[model samples]
Structure formats: C-alpha cells, structure tokens
Target chain A: MNTWNVAKLVAAKDLRIEARSRVITNQVLPFAAIAMVMFAFALDNENDALLVQVAPGLIWLATLFSLLILVQRSFAIETADGAIDALRVAGIDPGGIFLGKAAALAAQLVALETILIGAAVLLYHTEIRLGGVVLLVTTVLAATCGLAFVGTLYGGLAAGIKGRETLLPLLLLPVVAPVLIGATRALEAAFGTGKAVLADGWPWLGLLITFAAAFGVVGVLAFGPLLDE
Target chain B: METIVDLRDVVAVLGQFPALAGASLTVLRGEIVLLQGPNGAGKTSLLRVCAGLLPVVRGHAVVLGHDLTVDRSGVRAKVGLLGHTNGLYPELSVRDNVQFWGTTVGASSGEIDAALDRLGLSLRLADVQVGRLSAGQKRRTALACLVARRAVLWLLDEPHAGLDAEGRDELDAVLRQAAASGATVLVASHELERAGALAHRTVQVIAGQVHEVEQ
Candidate 1:
C-alpha cells in the first residue's frame, strides 16, 4: 500500500477494533450525549438570547469533550496488543498511523455530532436554520480535526502516564484550546442567523484551517518522539 | 554482493536512559543474524533503530541503501517486522488481517495467499477471527505477514517464545528461507538453542550495549 492506502488500512483496523469493543458506544458517547441533553434541558427556560449566546460554546464544548474522551479508543487499539511497537518495528510510518487514527476519530466524532445535533433538535427542542446547519457542521468538523490531532498524541502519551483515566483530559485541553477558541467564535457568529454570509465566516474558518493544519503537521512530527519515548 | 543492512557504532539515548549504545552491526544480503539478549539488553531497541523506528542520538544506520536517520521512509518500505506483538488485527479474520497488513506493506493478494501457504495457514485458519487464535497461531500469522511482505530485511523480535515444536520449526524454516532468498534477517529471540540451529551468526547484547558471542 502507498501513503493513503496505509492510512486507510490503519484507520479501518481501528474502526473494526472499536466495533468489537463497544467501549466508545458504552462509555464515552453516551455520557457526552447525556451531558449535552442535560445542558439543553437545564437552560431551556432561560432567556433565549442568553442561551443563544452561550450555545456556541456549549455545543462545541460538548462535542469537544466527547471527541477528547472517545477518540482515545483509536489509540487503545495499539496500546492493547502492543501494536504500536509492532508497527514501529515493521518500519511503518508513524505519520500514517497518526493520520489513520485521526481519520477514524473524525468518522466517530462526525457520527456523535450528528447524534448530538439530532438530540438538540428533538430532545432539546433546539432549532436549526439554513445558516445554522452550515455553522454547526463547520464547527463540528473544525473542532473535531483539532481535538483528533491533539488527542492522538496525548492518548499515546497517556498510555504511559500514571493516572491516565484522570490525566488525559488535563493533558489534552491546554494544547487544543486555541482550536477550541477559534471554533467557538466561528459558531458564535451563527447567533443572529439572518444571512450570516460566508465572508463573515472566512476568517474563523481560515483560523480553524490553520489550527487543523498546524495540529496535523506538529502532531505528526511530535508523535514519533512521544512513541519513541 | 550488497550489504542490505549496515550499522556503525550506533548510540541511541532516550532522555537519561540509554536504549542502545555503541551498537555496530550489519546484515549482508541473504545473511541470517540472530540477536540474543536478556531483558533491557536493547534487543528491541537495536532492531527498532535498524528499522528506523527509533531515533539514534549518534552513529549511522542504513538498510537497503536507505539511511535510517535521513531516508527512513525509503528504508521502511524494504523492511518487515514481527515483534512480540507481531501485527495482528484481532477483530479481523485471519484472511482479512493478512490482507490489510499486505495492503500497508504493499503486497498483493496472491503474495499474501502464498505467504499463508508457506506458513501452513492458507487452509485451516483462513476465516477464523484473529482474536480467537492461540499464541502460537498469532506468532505464525505474524510470520505470514513477513512472508507476504518479501521485503529486503526481516526484523523478528522474540518471534519464537510461545511456539510449540512444529511452530518453532516452521518459524525456523521461514527465517532460513528468507535469508536464503537474499533477504537479510535480524531476529532478536529468547529461544537460544533453537535459534542456534538456524542462525548463521549470533550476537548478544546486555543492558543497551553490544557484545560479541560466537556460539
């Protein structure tokens, strides 16, 4: 296999492993969904403007939490059977492994985001207009990219950390905050929701892209060192 | 006569810990070199550096004419590794696991099947999920990946620890065949007597340092 081919193989392997385990479904996704649903319920009666104002952060935060918690499952595949060492010894590119894992994580986060969006509409009684859809999808993808990139590294590092169950969140949040900030701001732009032109979004989207790109490059370069560690 | 593998006084340090130090080793085309060492002897670390999987703080390593420090991506394509973990997709059936790794290593389906045939796994365990396989079978399946890969260098780490007699023989034949076919083999094994049968030369390592042991 070539570059993307190896990535696909690695990602598909991760997905298959995730399917077999159900850890993502049982632990991370459900808790995140419940958290989102509860937040929407808790604030259902508050001032509409206030809820809208915070909605961007709340939604992105929930999604980011879920991605951070769940995406570690992708890394678990390697740490479980010592597959990371095997892959490294196989002379496989750590970059390919990272991208493959990030890809798998992106797929899982997209699914979870769709579930949350549905929950927001039906259970939470949140509304989505034309521009709302654009903003939501953009926020979901951009945030997912940033979290997936950062999470993969920490998840691998956490494999060695003492209190990984508790420490993973602490290790991940600070590194990923910039991406989170840019994404939250971009989603906040959807507040008034009349026209919300793409030009208005161009900068935030650009920032999001830069964060994702930087995370990708930096994550790839740095993960090798962490793995070697 | 080409040197498919070369290493020159390789010193690799991980922070304060020394992983491999003053490690000079080589594997010419079709040579089978058995690497035996106790735990923490840098056996895995040495193989990893050779495969370009680990960073070497000093010294140079080249595999198939690709430098470990510089042209790692190029060298990686020409090497196959079967470590203690030995690349297995537990969720996938034996066939699928083989096929997926084949894709990553750029081996064709026919080559994978032939590899399985060489390992005697082509018929019995084809459809079984890899997770269900026993330890020896997992090791065999990993070796199957090596057969399928047909790379220039085969890095086998602790490949024969849990195998039965037949399994051990099978792995021995696999290594011998790979070496005979002009693929340099660097195996780090705990099974010394068994390895003595197949290895052309044996090199010992201790606590991240190399020692010459002719047995």
Candidate 2:
C-alpha cells in the first residue's frame, strides 16, 4: 500500500471509531456555540477597525481552541483501551498516523468554523463577502492544519507525562504561536483589502504555509522515535 | 534458514537505568524462544529492543539481517509486537477493533475472522465496545493481534498477564501454530513452567544479561 492509502485508512478508522461515541458531538457543538456567544458579548455589535482588525484572528483562535478540545482523537481513547499500540504494531508510520489524525481533526475544525462564521454574521454583525468567504476558508484550513499538525505531535510527547492535558498546551502554544499570529494577520488583511489583493498578506500566509510544511515534516520524522519508545 | 533475530552485545538503558547492559541472543526461524526473568530483569526490554521498540544504549540487535538501531521500521514490518499495553480502542466494538487493525496491517477480512476464531473471540463480541469486555476477553483481544498481518517475529510482552486458564491455553495453541508456520516467537513471561511448555528453550535474564539454561 502507498502512503495515501496508509493515511486514508488511518483517518477512516479514526472517524468510524469516533462516530461510535454519541457524546463527541455533544462535546464539540457546545464549544462552537459558546465561542460565538463570547464573540457577541466581547464585540458588542461593534465593527470598529481595531475589533475587525482582530476579528479573523479572534475567530480563528476560537476555532483552534475548539479543535484542541475536540481533537481528543489522539488523546482520550488511546489512554483507555490501548488502541495505539495496534497502530504501532501494524507498521503504520507515525507521521502517516499524524496525517490521519490531522485529517480527522480538520473535518471537525471545518464544521466548527462554519458555526463560528455563522455566529459572527448573526451576532457580531461581521461583514463577509465572496472574497472574504474564500479567504476565510483558506485561513481556517491553513490555521487548522497548523494547529492539528502541532497538536498531534505534542499529544504523543505528553501521552506519557504527568499532567499531560495541561502540559500539552504549554508545550504546543509556544511552537504554534507563529502560525496563530500569521493566520490571524492574514485573515485581517483578507478582510481589509478592496481588490482581494495579497501584497501585504503573503508574508503571513507564507508563514502559515511554511509552518504547516515544517511541522508536518518534523512530525513525520520525530513521531517514529517517540512512538517506538 | 536465516536467523530472524541476532543480537550483539545489545545494551538498553531507559531513563539512566540500564535494562540490558550487555545482552546477546540468537533466535532462528521456526522457533519459540521464552524469556524468563523476575519482574524487572529486562526481559521485556530485551524483547522490545529486539523488536525495534526500544533503542539500544550500547550495542545493536540485528533481526532478519536488518539492524534494529538503523532499520527500525523494517524490523517493525517483519515483527508483530504486543507492548506492555493491550492497545485496544475502548469506543470501537470488538469486530470494528479487529477489522480496523486487520486492514491497517493489510490483513484480508477472512484472515481477520479466522484469527479471531483461533482466539475464541465470538462474532457477537465483535459489535460490543471494548469497554464492556472482561479483562480476560481484553487479553484475548490483544492476543488476537497475534494473527495480525503475518509478522515473522512475534514479540509478546507478558502475554499471559491477565489471562485465565482457557486464555493461556488459547495462547499456547497460537504459539504452536505460529512456530509451525516458520514464524519466530519470543515471549517474556514470569510463568516459568507454562512458558517452558511454549518454548523448547528458555533464556533467563539476570541483571540485563541473557544466558542459556543448563541441566
């Protein structure tokens, strides 16, 4: 089997496994809803440039947080049933497993981002046009890839440590700050532009793309040593 | 037949403590090798290093002509390892668990079912979430991986940990069948007499070194 099938099978199995948990939806839906509610209260129906300046970042941040909570695919079940060793023994590459996990997390992130955007429109009076929509989608995809890519790597590292849940964010936040910063800025620029121009935006966009690529590659190589340990 | 596992002065130190300080052993194709030791005699550690799970601190283990230190993934492909953990998914039903893992290792559906049958895991249990499985059944589930994907080297760490008499019997049967198929089997066991039944030879691990048993 090629790398693509390895990734696909891993992702498919994870989704099917997660789908069995009726509580997963219940757990994720609230995170999306509340983030939107927080936006209304914090923004107070204001579209001031400062708030709008940061809106994309704020929304992306919320989505990332929600993904962090919802991305329990790598953490929760493995601790309980010892399912991860099956993957280790099955000859699946740790990096491929990371991609499988990231793909699954992205699906959840997309669903949550949709809710957040909807909430932004109804609650915060956020203006979103066709260009804005395309940029929003691109930003979230890149941002989520950054988050999932980094999150799954630390997830493995912290799996064996004490206070892992708490330890993970601390370890990951610093590594992912660049992506968060870059994604937030790109989204703001995406909203501010008149011609959907990307003169100033590419730097941040490039940072995000670079972050995802670097994190994905390192994750693939390092995960094997960590998994075998 | 080529020796599936050949270790040369392999020493594994975990977190400042050396588990296998200067251990060496050779396991050939079609043999069941038992590693008997006290609770912390490095039996599992030695087996893991041999299976490419643990890195060698001092020396190297060469399995199937692949160095465990250099070609760990290659060693992994040719070996089936049951870590100290059972590694089952609590949310997935038993059948999904087996099939998910079966496909991951490139096992055909029929092969998975047949392996499950050999382990005495009922088809009905396939749909039941692993959270509901009894400890014995969980061990059975972990052992079901024995037939996962035709791995030549079966590295079982404490395979009988939670098994009942019947489960141990099932494991013995699998070991015999796997050896018959020319698969090299290495089991780390605390159960002395029972493990002796599974392997024609026993290597006692004492203070990170392995030596053959003498009459």
Candidate 3:
C-alpha cells in the first residue's frame, strides 16, 4: 500500500463507519437544517426578500457550524478504540493519516453542503442564474477543501486535550475567517448582490482556491508532527 | 544475537512527570522479556518508548536497530504495541477491526483469517461489533491484530488484564509462538505468576528505572 492508497483506505473506513452509524447523516444534517430554519425565522421580519438577499451568508454560516461538528466527530471516533495510537504504530505514512482525515471531512462537508444548499433554495426562495450556480458550486468546493484541511489540522492538535471540543472551535474559527469571507463574497457576486464587486468576484474565487491549496499542502506536511505524541 | 531493544539511562517525560526517569534495559532478538511493575512505575511508558510512541528526552535508546532519538517513526512499521486499551473500533465488526489493522500493515487476507481463527474468533463473532463483545473477546481481537502484523518487536501492556482462563492460555501461546518465530516480546503486566511462566526473563520497573530480576 502506497501513501495515497493508504489514505483512500483510511477515508473509506471513515465513510463506512459513518454509513453504519449515521451520526452525521442523522444528527448533523438535521442540526444544520433546523439552524438554517431558525435563521429564516429570526429574520422573518424582513420577509422572503431579505432572507433571499442574505442567503449566501446564511448558507455559509450553516456549513461552517456543520464542518465543526463533522471534524469533531471524525477525530473523536479515532480515540474511541485507541485508534489514534493504532494509526501511529501501524507504520502507514503519517501523512496518509492526515490526508485520509482531510479527505473524509471534505467528502462529508460536501454532502452536508448539498443538503444545506437545497434547504436554502427552498426556504429563502433564492433565484440563481446558471452562471451563479457554477460559481456557487466552485466556491463551496474550494472553501470546503480549505476548511477540511484546517479542521483536520486543528482536530489532531486538539485531540486528547482537556475540553478539546470547546478548544477546537477557538483554534479553528479564527483561521477560517478568510474562508468564510471569500466564500460568501464569491457567492454574493454570483447572485449579483455585489454589483460593484462583480468584476472582483474572480479575485475572491482566487482567494478561496489559494487558501485551499496552501492549507492542503500545509496540512499534509504538518499532520505528521501534530499526530505524533 | 542482534539487540532488539537497548536503552541506557533513558528519560521520557509525560507532561510534567517523567514516566521513564533514567530507565535502561536491553533485549536481544527472539527473547520474551516480561515487564513487571506497580502502578505509576513506568512499565507502560517503557513499552511506549520501545514501540517508538515516546521519544527519549535524554540518554540513549534504540528499538529494532532504529534509534529512538533519531527516527522513531522508522521503527513503528516493524513494531506492534497492544496497550491496556483493546484499540479496536467499537463500531467496526471484529472482522473489520482486524482487517483495518492487517491492511494497514499490508497483510494478506489469508493471514488475517488465520489470525482470527488462531484467536478463536468464530465466523459469528467475526461479524459482531467490538462493542458487543465481552472484554475478553475484545482482547482477543486486539491480539489478532498483532498476529496479523507479524511485527519484529511486540510491546504488550497488561496483555492478560481482562482475559479469562482460556483467553490467558491463548495469549500465552501466541506470545510463545511469536518468540519462536524470532520476534522479541516485551510484556508489561502485574500478573507475575502467569507472565513468569511465559517469559524467558522478567524485568521489573520501579520509579521509572529498569532492574533485572533473578529467575
């Protein structure tokens, strides 16, 4: 088994575990859906117009929280059976473990984003052009890549620490601020809400891509040390 | 014989505390060295050091001919550690848990099945989730991983802690078999009587230092 092969195996194991447990499918997705509904109700005073106007931000917010939960669950499972130690001693490349985790997180976040996007479309009565749809999907993928990389990096850092569940967000949220801003701005431009920044949308997309590529590489390199005890 | 583990005044700190406070010991290939110690005596830490899970903060330590201070990760591929925890995924079936570990180390399917069979995990039990198994069964599944791994150095911490009489016998047989195959086994256990019967030699730990015990 090579590095990528091992990573795929690890990710497949996680996906299988999730498929059996349905912890994310059953719990996290509903939590995201309900939270998005709450956002709609909270801003009900502004009616559908206001809700649709801010749909991009609301969707991104929901995805961010969902990503947090997903990352926590991913690492928590590794600790359940001393899986972390197992990974360390198994002799597989540590980078494989990191990439495996990040890949799994990205897959789950993409699944969650699909559901959240559907909910956003239905509840917010949002209208998106064909071009806007392309931009939205691209933005989600880039942002998810960056988020998954950072989340996996921070997840390993926070594992086994006191109050790690609480500590993870503190470590993660600040670093992902750019992802949120870039993703939302790109989405906004896609929706024609960023009238003056329409031409600038490409730059925002570039930011998302850069963040993804940078963190993806760093996470692969840094995961080995972070995972080591 | 080549030395599988050699440590000279090794100091390994866990948090603010020194788990292996100037600990030192050596084991040649194919020897079953029993590690006996009381609680907080650093037996577990010593095994971790040998398995390359812990870096020696000071002094000299080498495992499987790989220096602990240099490239600990290099030793990991050939070393298998079965700690107090079963380290098998609770959600995964006995088969899946064993398969995961076996596949990680590039073991063949035939080897995996042979290990499971050797550990007496029946076809029925093989599909059962680890959480559903008794503690003894979980330990067996964990042992199956070590068998499948066929590692050079086996570091077992409390290998007999949760086993029944039959499980203990099975584990002893496994340890003996591993040793006969030229694998070095370092076991940390409080069960001195059983461990003594299985080990070629016994080394007790006290306050993070290793001392030889006369058989």
Candidate 4:
C-alpha cells in the first residue's frame, strides 16, 4: 500500500527470518566478541591506559567487519530462490525495498554494537561517564544510518556476482572511511582520556549526519537502477 | 485485442553476449502461449524481458501499458514471474513465504489461503519451512505465491521442471484456470509435448528471435 507500510513489511520479514535462523546472534555475535577480546590481547591487557586509548578505534573496526557480514548475509538471503527477481517484479517501489533493507541492517548493527561495546568496556577496562550520553547516541545513530545506507547500496550492487564477498568491502570501505573516522573520534571524545578535543562531540556528529543524509538519499534513488538487470 | 506484451526488435545484452538479439513477440490479454527452444536459445531471457527484469537497450518493448525504455518499474507490480528459482526463503514457513509475496502485492489474507489451497499445499505444510520440503512441495509453494498475487501477466520459466505427474496435472489446470480468468500466461519449457498441451499457440525462439510454430 503506502511506502512506509511496505518498508515495515519488508523489515519485519527480515527480522522474523533472523529470529528464526539466529545466524547473527549465534555466529556473528561470538565472532565479534572474540575479535574484541583479541583486540584487548593485542593491546596488552596489563596496560589499561593504552587499552582505553585504542578502544574507540577497535570498536569501530569490529563494527565495520560485522557490518560486512551483515550486509553480505542480507543480500545472500535474497539471492536464494531467485527472490531478487520476485522482489523486482513485486510492485513494491525499489526505494521502499531499499529503506526496508537498510532499516533491517541498522537494527542488526544496533545489536552488534551493544554486544561489542559491552565487551570493550569489560575487557578493555574503559572508563564510563554519564556526561555526553546524548552526543554518543547521536553519533552512533548517524554513523549507523550512513553505514546501513552504503551497505545496502553496495550489497545490492554486488548481488548475483561470484566474488561479491571480496567485492563488497572493496566497494564500501573507501566510501565509508569518513563514517569510521567520525564515529571513532566522537567516541574517543566522549570516552577517551583526552577530554579536550573540542567542547562537545558536535563537530564529529555533524560529519556523521552529513554522510548519513548524503548516502541515504543516494541509496534510495539508485537502488532501482542498481537492481535492474 | 489488448496486447499485454509487445516487443519489437528488442535487444538484451548479458555481459558481452546478446541474449535477446532483435527478438520480437506480442501477447494479448487472456492468452496462454508456449515458448519453446534449445538451451541458450533465450527462452528465459525473453520471459525476463517481458517481466521487465531484463532491460531492452534497443528497439521497442512494452509490458502492461508501460514503456520499458522509459521506466520498467511501473509494470512490475502488475506482473508475476516464476523463474527457475522458487524465490522462497528457506528459513521461512510456506505460509510466511506466500504472505510475503501476497503482502507485496497487497493481497488479502483470505486470497492468500485460497491461492495456497489451489496449489494443494495443506494447512500442515503451510507452516513448515520451505527448506524442509521436497522440491515438488517447494515448487507448489512458489506457485501458491504466484496465484496469490493475482497479477495480470504470468511468466513461468520451466515451471514443470521439478514436479511429479500429479503436480504437473495440477499446474496444467492452474494454467487453464488462470487463462480462463483473463490473465495472460507465458510459459517457457523444454518439455514440448506437455507444454504444448497447455498452449493455444506455440512460438519458437532461436537466437533471441521469435517465430510462430505451426500447430
């Protein structure tokens, strides 16, 4: 019917499928948890000061890797049974489909971030502060949106190709460099020992929001043509 | 006659190869036409072109009153294509898969059940995941989805490939019923004798060109 309603339907389908399969929770979650632990080992767990210093960058890196998996799985699920063809001809607007996919991916990212952040705090012994919580949430949301937008676009771009697993990160990493940097810097400003980068995380948050808006709009507009054979 | 599909010298390229090299065909409303050809003869490509999945880079191609050159998305909602892949989610139940397609086209819940029942998928199998079902059952589930959409144009590619005798008979009845209900049907199959039984006319596709086959 309506665009928003259609998007909800698509998102609901993906979430329902994920809930049944538990691929992300059972497989990817453990992989990210182990990755975070490895990062701690890499930084030398005895040195809490250095661990805190690099936790922000490691968190973003873990999220990026997890995102690559999530995006690839999202497209792979559709590749089965020629579902992509069904989707193209199903009468739903391509933009609606793109929004639905991006939303589902964003939801998965939220889960991954929560788990990875929890691991980072416990393993890395990072300090927690109640201040700047709003900015932290804003930064995460903006960055998530940006990643999901580009992920969905490139995921669609790489569908049906044999080398998509290797191709997606190649297509996505360069475009998403700004997101990783902006998000990490914002987190560092919020949680790092260097408390005087700027008054607030506003500047980095602004960068994240701009990236989100630009890529989000582009993804919606380009999804139809990208999926067309 | 209301022509649902009209392709004139349409060219579709897949990588460096031209799948539809100057192919042309027309299908009217409520007609069941069989498309027969060898492997790589472009039967699948022609069906794809009709469904607006393949872009026509040259000449004229139209479906459901929308020009493919201008925008193919306009015709997608009104067309249902059942390709080689069943297009069902392996993790999702039969009912869920059917509902996904149904909801995509805005079909009512009642209509969804009726479509499933028409394809002989009982209530028991409806809740079972598609991955657990046999190939025939999966095909039936996909056919249920196509029926649920109630689309005006139906493009079936090798629809009877995996089905047993009973399932084949059921599909034949479904095709006849669909045409009787005024939906255009185009089926591509290598099973010439069986496919011919369901067609009012047959068209041969050779190297992406369409020619009428004498009955």
Candidate 5:
C-alpha cells in the first residue's frame, strides 16, 4: 500500500535479477562499446578532428540504441511468465511500479552512458574540459531520467502485444527524438564541439529537465491503465 | 452463510469476444466450488472476473464486499488467481519468489518459510532457481506463494494439471485445509473425479452460462 516501499521492493527485485543474470555486462554493454567502434570505423578516417567533432552525437546515439535493448529486456522478464499479472493482482501500486522500473532503468542507463562517454574520449580524442564537467554531468543525469521514464512508459504500453519487439522502437523512437536532439546539442555545447559555450548548454538542460518531469508524471498516471489494458 | 461472491448477468468481453455472456453465480464463505466446462467455456474468464482482473462490461458483480463494477481493484489484494502460468520468476529462487509475493500482504519471513515448507520445498530446494525446477515443483511453488499471501478468495485454473499423483493429493489437501480455515475457493478444473471429490458443490458452465450440477 505504501508507494515508496513498493517502489523500493520492485526496484530491488529488478536490480537483483539483473545482477544475477549478468546479461547487461555480458551482452548489452559489449554491444554498446562495439557500436562505438563500428561508428568510428564507418567514418573511415584517421582524422581526429572530425571524430571529435561528431563524438557527442555518436555517444548519445549508441545510448539510445542500447536503451531499446534495455527496455525490451526489462519488459521481457515480466511477460515471460505472467509476472506482470501477478504484480497487478498483488495490489502493488502501479505508480510505485512505474517509479521503481524507471529508477532501475535510469541506474542502468547511467552506467551505460558512463562507459560510452569514456569510450568517446578514448576512441574519438574528445576533450573533457574542467569548465564543462559540471554541465556534462547534469546533461547526462537529466537525459538519462528522461530516457528512462519515456522508455518505461512506452515499454509498458507495448508489453504483452504480439510483435512488440518491432513495435516498441517505432513507438519509442519518435517520442524520444527531442531527448536525442537536446542531449546531443547540450553535450556539444559542453564539449565546445563547434563554437558553443557552457552557457548555451544550460538552456538545453532546462529542456531536458522539463522533458523528464513531464514524462515522469505521465508515466505514473498512465502506467496502471496501460498495464490493465 | 456470508456471500463471498455475487454476480448477476455479468458480461465480460475480450476484444469483442463475450467471454462471460450474462453469466450469474453465487458463492458463500468457506465453500469449495468446482467450475466444470469445456475449453473456452468462460470458466477462466469467470475466475478472472472474480479476481478483479477482468472488467464486467455489463451486470452487477461483487466480491468481498467490493462492488467490482464500481471499483474492481479493491478486491485484488484479498484474492489470489493462479492461472495456467505459475507466475513465478524463473530467475528467482523458490524462497525469493514466495517471499516477494508474500511481502505484498506484509507476510513475515516466518510465514514465507512455512508456506515453502508446506509445499514440500526443503531448505535445499528453496535455494534453487525456479527455472530449474520441474513443472510439478513450479506449481507447488506457485501454490506456496498463494498460501503465503493469506488470500480470502482462491481462484485456481487447472491447479492440478502439472502435478503427479502425490503432488495432486498434496494440492487437494492444501485446498481443503484452506477451506477449513474459512477461505472460499473457485477451481476451474477438467479433472472432475479428483476435484469433484474435494468440492462441496459443482457448477457447469456452458456457452458462458452457469447451470447447477445438483450434487
């Protein structure tokens, strides 16, 4: 009945399952790193300036694709054995379930993004300036929250449907376009990729905050009905 | 006797298919009622409706003093529905699965242990992942979870399907014990000979309508 308590329980359950399964470490993370490598090779150049200029968008792009895999894996666990129905019948607050799932996803995304950022610096010769560190952290956190909330909401929407594997990306990609654009632009400003300043990136952070807040509220309200349907 | 379930002309649909076409049934407290019907005769739908998992499109329905048509969610915590799937997380251990469901109702660790023990999951077996267990063991684990929830209403669909002879007898005993403790049970089972012996009454569901079997 207590929403916070339920959220904690559900989040812990999901994290524990993930820890035991090792799927992210064994599969998804490597896939993301490999995607970064593939992106570097696709440009077909040893020119460090070009790779550095494009690294921000490339990192976020890898994160987005990895997010699709994470969301699918998250819901797959629930639908595999009707555990979602059991959760509904158990009378756990759906809002709490939404928060819990989103939180776990945000945590995973943070880890994935951290690795991807490091990959960018290593592979693309991108510079992380001392002045931009604060804005970069803020951008990653806010963007992760927005992506997690939207991913959980859309994942629940597409759950239990036949061919949801194909449907989820179609439904999710359009909704997340703003996030991709916002995060990339913010990161570009933070990295000073083109002639941008840290002040310019702060405004994009505002957009990311609003996006996260808006989707967070909508996910909590709509998740229950979506699960029921 | 107190009425635990009351339905009149309840109509429920699954994407345009009227799964419960104006079906009516009444069940009292502490009664074990068997629902007999062929496949797709609305038996599962009826149980789902009682468990508050299905919406009543038209008609009046109430379970545990909660008017389902008004608010079906209120009855969910007090009822347990065991459908075809065991609803167990394959990656979780037996104890973890039972504990997770049990904690929803605030059941303590001791109660979880007792439920696992009641279902013959020893300490060794309780530590094993449910995915590795046999079909019969998974069913038992599911039953253990239901017991741990301390549900007032039991909605079991083909509960005895995957059990061996001994497991089947054990399941029947568990149901009888639950009934003795004043819990109402509605079981949709094809094994009439076994379930009929355990039920106090039997009702036939034909074409989404209920007919008394006159036990």
Candidate 6:
C-alpha cells in the first residue's frame, strides 16, 4: 500500500473522530486554558515585570502538560476497542500509521499552542515584535512537530499496557525535556525576553528541527515494534 | 487443494506463558475449519499467529504463501481476524468504521455499500455511531468491514457470540459465500452445534495442541 495514501487516510480518520468526539475542544483545551490561568494566578502576587519575563516558559509548560493529555487521548482511541490490532492486521504500513498519528497530533498541538500564546499575551502583557513573527511561527511549528512525534512514539509504547495512564508520563517526560527547554528558550528569544535577540532563537530553532527530524525518523521505524509489544 | 495455512509444531508465547505449545494444524483453501477448545486453550493465539498478529517463536508456519517465521507481517493484508472486540471505532458512525477498514484494503465505495447491505445495516442505521448500536449491530458492522476487505483468509473468534439468530444466520451465510469464493476460514467458537454445521472440518484444541476429529 502507498504509505502516503495510508497516512492521509489515517490522519483524516483521526481528525474526523476528534471533530465528532469534541474531547480535545471541550475537555483538553479547557483544561489547558485553566492551567494557563492558574499559572498566571500563581504569579499574581509577584511583580508584573516578573510575569512578563517568565511568560514564555509558563506557556510552554502548560503546553507540555497538555501534550501529555493529548497523547493519552490519541492512543486511547486505538486501544479502546482493539482498533490498533485491526490496523495491524490490515497491514497498513506502521510508518504510515506513525506519521498519520503524529501529523494529527501536531495539528491539534498547533491549535492548543495558538490559544495558549494568546492567553499569555493577554494575561502576562507580553508584546510581539514584527521581526519575531517568522521566528515565533517557525518555533511553534518545529516544537509542535517535535512534541507530537515524541508523544506519538511514547504513547504507542505505553499503549495496551496496564497502568498506561501513569506509565505514559513517566516514559515521556524525560524524553521531551529537550523540547520543553528548546521551545521555551526559542520563545523567550522571539518574545524579546531577557534581552535576547532574534538571532539567538535561530540556533534554538535548529535544535527543535533536529529533535523533530530525529524523532520523526525514529518513530516511523520503531512504531511497529512498539505497537506489537 | 492448495494449502492456505500450514503450521508444524508451532510454538508461540504470550509473555512467559506458552500460549501455543507444539501446536500443529493445516487448512486448505476454500474450507471452513472450526477450532473448539476451552478457555486458555490457545485458540485465539492460533488465529492470531495465522493472521500475523502473534509471533511463531519456534515453528515452521506459512499462511497464504507467506512464511510467517520469516515475515509475519507479509500475510496480514490478505487475512482478516475478528477477535473478542468488534474493532469498530465507537465514535465513528457504522458507515465510517466500515469505510475506514474497507479503504485500507482498497475496497471501492460500491463494495462498501454492498457489504453494508449484506450485513443488513440500513442506511439510517449505518449513519449512527457504533457506540450507540446494539451488541449485535456492532458485530454486524465489524463483519461488514471484513466483508469489504475481501480477505483471502478469515480468522474469526467467537464470531457468533453477540449476534442474534438472524444475525448469526447472516454471518453463516456470509462465511459460506466467502468460502465459496475461495477464501479459507478458521473460526474458534464454543457454539459447536451451530459452528459445526457451517464448517467443512472440525479440529479440537486441547492445551495448545490440535487434534483433528473424524467428522
């Protein structure tokens, strides 16, 4: 079977399910938004300058937490009715399945990140410079891809295992440390926090790109074995 | 008759437990073989092994001309296995679930529609989410997906469990039609009287071993 076609089909199926279920929009999104608000409230007693300085890190921290929930939700669908086994038996390419799931996850994370960034702008009074728009967009895309790839990979690893709900974060958090740090740093630069220049963020974007590419390759090759296990 | 499945002393493991210990069975094309065994007798493991979902640890096994020991994934596309769960997405409509699985095998829209009709899933029912359907209806939907797949080998485990009398009759008819079209079927079921009537041969699975009954 053509991997591209299978990827498209799987991605479309997942997105369609998400659209119908409304779990991401109704539950995960609100949870993420609430978490962001909580972060802002935690810093309410602190000075406004401190909140502005830390807005990027706080936004990404919320995104990372939400990533865990999104990953759990994505794999839950496959294991809920033993649909993963059906997919395996159908002989759809494992790499295609991995890519399809990751793409869908990336799409969802993009939406989540967009809202979180908006919330940060309003809650933390962070300013966006014209020169940083390209950098910020690039950082979001790259970091989202990195997180999605890792999430899908680890989610597949934890799928079908007893206690996977708890196991997923354990297996996932350390692996994504680089993404959290790299994305936060890049965003800090893009947002002109800590007096960092846009040029400084480009190097961080390189790390994000490499992380995404590495996991993308590894996820495609490893997903089959993980799914079987 | 061409051999559709050949397993000689197949040994399969689930974790540390030997799910299939020295099991041997052979099935020919266009034949329906019933696998009857008590719980934990390795019946599902055997079907999974044949479908390429389970590994053959130490055995010579081939299904649909693919050496499973060499490449278990190769035969997967040509075989359909229906396990305990219906394998239908609960959130997706009956038609969407059927269409998704059917699309994997390159089944056309016409084929999907025909499969739905064959399973007695009316257009109105087809539009309903599988989660909302009755147990028998969900089974029918999963069967519709298998029908649309046009698999050369069918591996069904307790396929009649949740099905009603009419649904069971429909399943029997679908299996017969598939076998007549040269598809091999290996069904593990407890409903011996019902399954035995539809099977061309009956094999007993006792403690992960196969013993053919003189039918």
lDDT of the candidates, in the order given: 0.75, 0.75, 0.88, 0.88, 0.93, 0.92
Estimate candidate 6's alpha-carbon lDDT, on a 0 to 1 scale: 0.92
Q: In candidate 2 chain B, what residue range of length 10 has the lowest lDDT sum?
A: B142-151
Clashing pairs in 2: A82-B87, A82-B88, A83-B87, B95-B126
TM-score computed on alpha carbons, candidate 2: 0.89
Share of true Cα-Cα contacts across chains kept by each model = 0.53, 0.65, 0.75, 0.91, 0.65, 0.81
Worst 10 residues of 1 chain B by lDDT: B69-78
Error of 4 at A150 (Å): 1.3
How close is chain A of candidate 1 to the true chain A, as a TM-score?
Answer: 0.86
The collision pairs in model 6 are none
Cα deviation of A158 in candidate 1 (Å)? 4.8
Q: Give the distance in Å from residue B102's predicted Cα in candidate 2 to where it truly belongs.
A: 2.6
Residue lDDT tens for model 5, B1-215: 99999999999999989899999999999999999999999999999999899999999899999999999889999999999998888899999899989988899999999999888996689999999999999999999999999999999999999899999999999999999999999999999999999999999998888888987
Off by over 4 Å in 5: none
| DockQ scores of all models, one per candidate | 0.42, 0.54, 0.79, 0.85, 0.79, 0.86
Weakest ten-residue segment in model 3 chain B by summed lDDT: B83-92
- Give TM per candidate: 0.85, 0.89, 0.97, 0.96, 0.98, 0.98
Number of the top candidate by DockQ? 6
Candidate 5 C-alpha error for residue B87, in Å: 1.0
Better of 1 and 6 by lDDT: 6
Better of 3 and 6 by lDDT: 6
Which of the predicted structures, 2 or 3, would earn the higher TM-score when compared with the native? 3
Evaluated at residue B119, the lDDT of candidate 1 is 90
First chain of candidate 2, TM-score: 0.87
**Which wins on DockQ, candidate 3 or candidate 6?**
6
- After superposition, the stretches of candidate 1 with alpha carbons farther than 4 Å from their true spots are A40-56, A89-95, A153-165, A178-207, A220-229, B67-73, B206-215
The per-residue C-alpha lDDT of model 4 at residue B176 equals 94
